[model samples]
Target chain A: MNSRSWFRLKQNAPKLSMLAYMVLFFIFLLGPILIVVAISFTETEYVAFPPKGFSLRWYERFFEYDAFVDSFIVSVELAIATAVLGVGLGVPAALAVTRGHVPFANTIMTFLLSPLSMPLIVMGFALLFYLSALGFGVSFLSLLIAHTVISLPYVVRTVAGVYRGISPDFEESAAVLGANRLQIFWNITLPMIKPGIFAGMLFAMLISIDNLPISFFFGSADTNTLPVVMLSYLEHQFDPSIAAASCIQLIVAVIGLFIVERIYGLDAMTPAS
Target chain B: MILKRSGITTVSAGVVSPWWIAFTGLFLVVFFVLPIVNNLLNTTELATLAKQRPISFYYHKLFTDPYYIRIVFDTVALSVGVTVICIIIGYPVAMFLVRHSGKWSGFIIFLLIAPLLTSIIMRTFGWRVLFARRGLVNDFLIWADILEKPFMFLNSASSAVVGLVHVLVPFMVLSIASVLRSIDLQLEESARILGASRVKTFLKVTFPLSLDGIGTGFIIVFLLANGSFVTLLLLGGGDLKTLPLLIYQQFTISRDFQFAAAMSNVLLAIAVGCLYLQLRLIRRKGVKGS
Candidate 1:
């Protein structure tokens, strides 16, 4: 066969294999997501797949139930707190590492990312013991501290990547024009890194809210996040309500991830995925 | 010289040193040292917990016992089983995603990643529903007479592995896809031009180049599958107990914090050590190859 035919052979793959892969992945990833969405609309008595009938029952059940609503509110509050705390701890650290000219900068940065690489279960138990011994006793602040720890890496990495993208000349120019270090940062560096910071916050919030094992230890009945709440519901029985709660969180998570991925570009995220 | 010294002094005094130091200090304290300290605390608890009864018996059973060792082996076997399964299943999908271009590539990429957006709880909930006794999956199979009746999919260990593979296959696909993206398509084309058949060209040129991606993907999926709690906790359906879920159970339901901590510390150490070794080995190999 000529080279053209052989090239045709290579090109033939996309149409066939790509379509097959796309279908398989779509079903694999979104199949369950779609199931949850459908189950939320499910009018059945029990959690049913290819949900028997469509109604607003599950979603209605969620809002009508105060515990679920409280957990939802708690999740939102935790996510917001996590975002704020993470950015607070992360941005300065990111700036220092990226532009800090600190000795062993790379070594330090890797240490920051170590938490992300470590098993989260240990951290959760650690926080539980540490907070309990200190008399925090699974309180809101304790959860926030632990969540903030996990969230910090996202903020640091995102903003650091952003800082790397920007040339230092802009800051230097501001410095040359009579800006002090604080003014230079406020006027120039901060704004330049804002998108990264925003993306980082979004990522951090998702990590905080979606967290399972850690939340299990830190969450109390009143303080429970949605995942923790859902876990309790699941441990009890198979019902559409837990699925409803999951659907709600899943929608929010998708939107949150989309916004972050749009701003930061999933490609920009350390290639860790 | 004075101006330069002032600039340097100002940087060290006001901005640079403090930033790095603060970040390094915070990162070290929060992530690195604290978890290490915490894990050590868990490991130290094993002996202290020996007096606790059945849970304590469970610990001794796990440590000084035979059944516990078998469970540990089973856990590793399941993770490896699914890890290998995922690589087999995911590589073709990733390869195909890289082959498509233009609007198609954009569309395919979205489809591939969109599932990842959904909450794990939601995804697992969906899986549980479908795999339930009379759920859609069983309905289809039963209607088609693929099974005499709805065979148990939700409660079985095989089902648990399948659920995990479903959740984790995306990680593998994306990892391989990223590697494939970096692969020069021209090499495959050149191989074709040199008269290697399509199969031969792929086996010789494309597959070898994609090894790093596969390795990355395998490492990630294996680690995740190993450390996974929810998928096992929910889908394992009381039949399976992996290290993470077992750790959680020991601390919560059993109230054996010390033994839980020991097991968790061991698991964490194993995970981190394996990851570090994998990366170092890969880096060394990469350096040698280059």
Candidate 2:
């Protein structure tokens, strides 16, 4: 080839390499999850690749075991309670930081977001210590408190994000027109930021359900969360049942994310800052 | 009557008040701050258990113990390794997503976000299966004539790192992609018009502009990898131990809360230190960018 064509070929070579690399990288990331999903449908007793004749027996077995069923119920209930408590605490806090004249607002926000950076295991271990010191033992209440604490930041961040998006002009206009504070918040602000609050609530609930490290520390003989139960079960037996259980979580998360996307777009949830 | 008062109108009119702040503050202080503080104090409490044993005893035990020290090193080294690998692989993905912002980008972003939202235990379980002796990876290699038999891939540090990088690369991609999306396309076009090659323009303009995202993604992945134990716990076999795993064992199996509390405090300090550096990088990035 001529010099000019050779230069063009050189450019295309690196582009081709990059394309190939990205494809391989994504495959590395996604191939495992797909394999597990594929395996969950296997008809065989063992996890067989190319999954010998798909069947839903493993999923049936997942429900057949009472422990898995009980733990699944606990996870759902805990996540719901966490979402409720998270919103109850987080909304006011988000409002306080964004609108209220709270002293050191930035510091307070950092403190609230601190858990997002802290290691869950350390948080779990520390909670174990703190609860015992306060004469509270590991129970469902402690589990709820832990889940709520971790979920609070997501709620606050997302709510504060949407709250910031709303022009203060509308609320100010409402005030000028003689609407009371509660009336303005109830009628104008809440309606406008409803998508954000819903997004945050959905995220908080999903994360609570997916949580394992903190739940592992707080789980008792009778109060194991689903993820924790799956973990302990895997420690002894690696079966298609575990794959089915894991798929249930995967399905729930995907649906929750799709709903969040539908409501407010996942792009809105991305922390650009 | 309270709403009618104009003197307190500004405070009341806004959605938040001191009471709201105080309420959330109290909950955070009790549940969040106190637990961390309790761990700190428990370290001291363990130190004072006997007159002969002092605070230094725990410190000496922790720092001097070769096994525990190795765990700390292994955790940090693993995190660093994972972070480096993520940035290398994630930068291209992020660049692709940002530059090709259309139908394909949406699907790609969904692919990235799905694994992120999945349960950590499940994700780790997926890796565990892949690394198993009879897993797909080994089977594929054997079929390709790359190996005579399935090698011992499971429970190794490399396997654990593969699991971590799989989970965290998405975060790295998302962070960098968001930053890249904010960069003006005109900058690249301008550079090309000025006779710069594609590689030259990317190196001189694009890469530097995206450094903030790189820094942010690095710290986020590193801190998370350091804190994470599930990947290691489920994927790591034999004597492989990370700081989190050690803390877990101490707290649960040994029932050594004080020692576990000490280890946790140490880990917390490391996390905070990384956060401090990350904040500095962010501030620097902001100053330089603007």
Candidate 3:
């Protein structure tokens, strides 16, 4: 190599190695999921890596299983309800704290977002006994309440983050034009924070659907979520069907993420630092 | 009420109706605050219902019992181990993501986040597939002549740790990258112009500045790892019994809600302590930034 080329190669060496490390890191991050996907196509009764032959039998089995199918429907319904409730409760509170000039806004915001830091298992355990004591028992209502509490933070944080960014001048101008408080919110504020509300709702749904620890406490014949069902299934059986179920859940997640990426951008979805 | 400020007549001042705050606060107080209070109350009620000793009995057993003590030690150790691993492996990637990932930043962020969006159970299932006796890891090891027979990687403490690090490294990376992105590159350039080597500049200036990010990442990973039970339950094979795992058993098998409540309170204390430190760090950072 020429001396100039040699100097260039030395300059690029660290970058190239870092690139190499990044590739390895991606593989580590993604390898297991890929393996799960691969095994979902396995013809074997057991989960095989090379996956003896490419077949969709496990997928068929997943659909054919009543418990899996039922729980999946329950999870979807629960997630939808959670998203709605979380937004309803979270957005207005975020608005109150951010724009209402509430006293101790910082402390109130921290309290609202505190659920994000709490251990899910502890929260689930507490809710289980607490709700039972309140005569709610282990039912879907209790489950929804538990899910809403955990997901409320995402809705509040994202909406508050976005709302804080928006200049209050839009609302001020709207108010000056003789618009009422509701009109100012509806015509001026709501449209601006729609993306934040959308993102937060999606997060709430995603968190509710993917939750395991919380769902574990509330699982019954009627209330078992897909994750709860899948856990029980895995404990008793090790089969490729579980892989199929996992891949299906993964597909749902990807679709949700894809929508967020197309609209809000994934980079912007990072919780406020 | 109309408020006039800075020669402007503002009728509403954009103040949200107090009803919004009231409704949300009521919901939280009933559903969130009460449950925790109820959990605390359960600890006391166990003395009456189960004919057990007072609430102190459970706490005493947790701290005094050798088995419980060992589990507590293991839980903290596991959390510490996971946090250290995440930082060691995650910092470089965070640096690359912040400083070097120009065109690929979007795709890289997607890749980082996609795993997080996926259910923890699904991710753990992926590890299960890989660590199976006849799985890829065993196959690769045997094929590479690293062993004569397939070694069981499943259902062990080491496996649990590996699973956790894989699940949590993204959080660490994201936390550090967010902070790293905020750090001015000119500072590093100035250090270089001052005749400091690249390594010296990073160690002296960049590393010191990034401590807040590391601290944030540390607390987050530690808290998450500390609460994590699904990964342990799925991969731990009943060998590694952390408080969460024990609590899980209490609810599922033993039906000891009282003891479980007590254990979770301990877990809650640790999580709350970590969160307090994290909030303080963030507030301090915010103060410095402003």
Candidate 4:
């Protein structure tokens, strides 16, 4: 080959390597999950990959247990309650931080978001100790409060981000139209930041459902969240049933993301850098 | 509340109040701050066990105990290792996402986001399955004649690191990508037009420009890794014991409330230190960018 063509080929080499590396990274990210979903369909008694002779038996077995069903319902309940609490507290706080001339607004914002930096295990211990001290004990109520503490930051961050993007023009114009403060907020501000509010609530729900350490610490006999139950069960057993349950969770999360993407876009929902 | 007869701008200024801040602030204080503060205060009980003892009792135990010291060392070492590995792997994927655009980029991003949204417990379980004896990884290695016998893969420090990197790589990627996307491509173009090669331009321009993101991502992954428990518990296989695991044991298995409270305070201090540094870095970056 000519020297010119050789140089051109060399130029393409780095691009080719980058493409190859990207493919490998994708595989690394998705391979385990695809394996788990595949293993859940195994006809074998144990968890196997390239899963032996596909069967729906494990999924059937997962549904047969009332414990799994109850644990799942409890998790759902906790997530919903956490989302409600998060939004109720988060939206107004977002407004206060973004619009209100509160002293030390930056510090207050940091305090609201501080839990994101905390180790869940540490938070779990603190919550457990504090609740016991207050006579709350380990119960669903304590679990809900702990989950809310963990999830509230998502709502605050997402809504504040969206609110910051919105100019005060609409609210000002509404005020000029002789609308009162509450009316201006409900009529002008709320609708403008609805997408952010929705994104925050969805994220809060997802975080609450996926949480493990707090639930493990605060849950009682009848209050085991799904992750807590699956974890404790996995300690003793290795079977396709756990895989089946994981698939259910996988589907739920995927559905949540897809809905958020459709409505507000995934990039908007991701953690701000 | 009616504003005095003033213009619209004045009315708008009067609308905001500190009372709104109190609503969420109170909720956070009661639920979030109070719990942790209560835990910290409980450490004082360590001094009065049976009678008026010294406050240094639990603190002395934590510092003097070889097991606790080892746990702290392991936690820091594991977190550092995972942070290094994540940045190595995550930087390229992030670059690919930022430089490339199309259906493939969307699909790749979905692949990235899906795992992040899924439960950490579920993802760790997948690793547990993969690293099990006679699992896929073992089976593949054996089939390829790489191993003479099935080696135990789960519960090692390596397994815990692998699990943590998997769990946290997305955070690294997202943080870096967010900053990478904000970087001006024109700077790279200008560098190239000024007679620099692609590699040199990226090395001198793009990489330098993305350092803030790198710092942010590193801090995030480091914090999460330090605080992580589920991955270590599930994958650290019995061999790995982290500070979080020790705290859990202290609180639950041993039921040493005061000592556990003391340990929790130390862990909190470490985590909060990192967090404080991170917030400062981000604030400085914001100032420089604007």
Please tell me which predicted candidate would have the highest TM-score against the true structure.
3
Give each model a TM-score: 0.90, 0.93, 0.96, 0.94
lDDT of 4 by residue, B209-253 (tens): 888878888888998888887788789865888778777676657
lDDT of 2 by residue, B125-227 (tens): 7787777788878988999999999988788877888888898898888889988998998999999999999899999999999988888898889988988
RMSD value for candidate 2 = 3.2
Q: Which stretches of candidate 3 lie over 4 Å from their true place?
A: A1-8, B1-12, B43-51
DockQ of all candidate complexes: 0.47, 0.55, 0.63, 0.61
Find the candidate with the highest DockQ and give its number. Answer: 3
> Which candidate should be chosen as best, given lDDT against the real structure?
3
Displacement of the residue B54 alpha carbon in candidate 1, Å: 16
lDDT of 3 by residue, B54-77 (tens): 667889999999999999999999
Off by over 4 Å in 4: A1-10, B1-5, B14-16, B43-55, B143-145
Two-way TM-score contest, 1 vs 3, winner: 3
Instruction: Give one digit per residue, the lDDT tens place, for model 1 in A229-270.
Output: 888888887788887788788778878868876777665443
Q: Which ten residues in a row have the lowest lDDT in candidate 3 chain A?
A: A264-273
- Chain B superposition TM-score per model: 0.84, 0.88, 0.92, 0.90
Clashes of each: 0, 0, 0, 2
- Answer with 3 or 4, whichever has the higher lDDT: 3
Task: Give the least accurate 10-residue stretch of model 1 chain B, judged by summed lDDT.
Answer: B41-50
Which digits, one per residue and each the tens of the lDDT, describe model 1 over residues B1-290? 78866765564443433554574475458544765685574433434545644344445767776767766777678878998998898887787777755557756666666666566777778788778887788898989998997788886786788789988887888888888888888898899999999899989999998888888777778877877778887887758877787887887688777667767766777678767866685666569679
> Which should have the higher DockQ, number 1 or number 4?
4
**Better candidate number, 1 or 4, judged by TM-score:** 4
When candidate 4 is compared with the true two-chain complex, its DockQ is 0.61
